[model samples]
Target: MNEEEIPDKNIFMMCEALNCDALTELPASYSIRSCRPDELGIWKMMPFDDADSAKEYEGFMSNYFTTTYSGKEELFFAKTLFVCDRQNKPIATCLDWKAYDEFNTIQWFKVLKKYEGQGIGRALLSIIMQRLEMCDYPVYLHTQPSSFRAIKLYSDFGFSLLSGDNFGIRKNDLDECLPILEKFMPKKYFQKLRIINVPKEFEDMVNKYDTNQF
Candidate 1:
């Protein structure tokens, strides 16, 4: 999707601990599996909300993979996952990535608009968190106000908005984003949102990166 389309403030969230009990099985007829080398195209286009957006983002996604995960293609595919239909076609994808080789961060998480409202995204995220359980604490993710649904889901998994106007190389828009969420999201979901201090270690690790290559 085009950046201008959403125009929402970007925000950061962190899960200091995994909420494994929140994990639930995918609904019948769908399954989760590691991404395959041959399915790179499927992974790239998974983030767009629909087919038209996917087509518009195809080239940009291709280059994003090239520039961001360049030398780590094998590991990237290994850490990435797909939630597929009975036919084994990917309907959603996410990555348990260690950005800058320093800290764990969720990346490229999305379920096709058509398949949403199902339990696919929750199942996929649970599996990713299960995998990260052994890797590190305080997992982080970048998102925006436009993704309030995802923010609610992330909150269910113990992720809270990271407090501050800046996080590493990126500006934190949580202050601005929260008002939007309060206005649009159900009051109950909005009430459950939490804000936590950004971990110093995470901040230091990220600030070391001179550029936001990813």
Candidate 2:
């Protein structure tokens, strides 16, 4: 298929955004906590496992490892942060770390349906944001309108948005991935979930992301 060709139903999104600083915090927690080494894969796969297209989600995970994380799931595990329940069940998760050059992003953020309203996701993301703020580079993340709930959280944390049509978006990216962006999220709906990017003049590249993988 050509670059401008339409993507299939299984396609993912590439919307981009960045945060100049961390602007969120977590509520008090007496039971749930960060993921431990022994409880990695299960938690990492929980959100995808619960999806209608589990196979596609897993395939995307593998592709992501190849393109960004050097195909090393272990390295990703080390970089991941999962909030677990008293019995060690994965409640929420996120990965905030260096992705390319000085760009650090929050990846694979999720919260199980069973634990959505209690602030686990907010707390977990806050912890990751704290880690990112200490880093010297700019913190960024890739999410789409489908991840509707995340828009507010990322916006609150200062992540500015750039869609496929945004001038700040690089020509190469827009040309090669525009179809997928359009398919994953129509331009009109995507605009509503948009965020502002810091250093507005700098060009933006959207990585393969579906922040609401859950």
Candidate 3:
């Protein structure tokens, strides 16, 4: 989908009006919407730029197609929105959707660093949540431990940690997997584990960790 194919110009106008110096510099009111084919170029500006990243993106789309097209689900919502320049060139994005399951999880939310701190991420999240509520399902999402902003946004919207082993970690050794698990697991879950018989060695591993490395 090209810029010409975007049925609504309001998205473009609203983003442009912010006059953001960089994609990450966008204001709070700026929100995300569905992406058009032509807007894919802008969507590509998201942080990941490697083959592994590309493959994961393709996998998400494939899952959407199979589940929605196969009639296993009723609604399949994904996003491909552009953070536009004054001239409507996309500068940032957040794109993903929910499957119509009782456990609806929001996946693949991202934005360019240049557009951070502006309300763009929040806006996109709100749009997706509204859509999810309309479908009558509760929402959930997973984010890297380093994605402090994303976690805060989800929390602000009333999403809390689901109980009992949300981390999906099975390995007993902390050095082998705890760091990665920490990055993605909810904070409340992490706190709960701390009260148990956590080994001093494991606590040390977690204490010195930095989520951005992942």
Q: Which candidate is the best by lDDT?
A: 1
Q: Pick the candidate with the highest TM-score.
A: 1
Question: Per-residue lDDT for 84-112 in model 1, tens only?
Answer: 99999899888878788778889888988
Candidate 1 vs 3: which has more TM-score: 1
TM-score of each: 0.90, 0.62, 0.48
lDDT of 3 by residue, 66-99 (tens): 5433552222223445556555555555443433
RMSD of candidates 1 onward, in order: 2.7, 7.8, 14.3
Candidate 2 local lDDT, 1-214, one digit each (tens)? 4333443222122224334353445545524455565764455376653656555577666555566656455766776776766665666778865655335567778887777777667667777766643443455555544454565566555554543343222222323343454455545654544433334333333333322221
Q: What is the C-alpha lDDT of each candidate?
A: 0.83, 0.53, 0.43
Better of 2 and 3 by TM-score: 2
**Candidate 1: regions farther than 4 A off:** 1-6
User: What is the Cα-based TM-score of model 1?
Assistant: 0.90
Ranking by TM-score: 1, 2, 3
Off by over 4 Å in 2: 1-40, 49-52, 71-75, 134-137, 163-214
Q: What TM-score number comes out for model 3?
A: 0.48
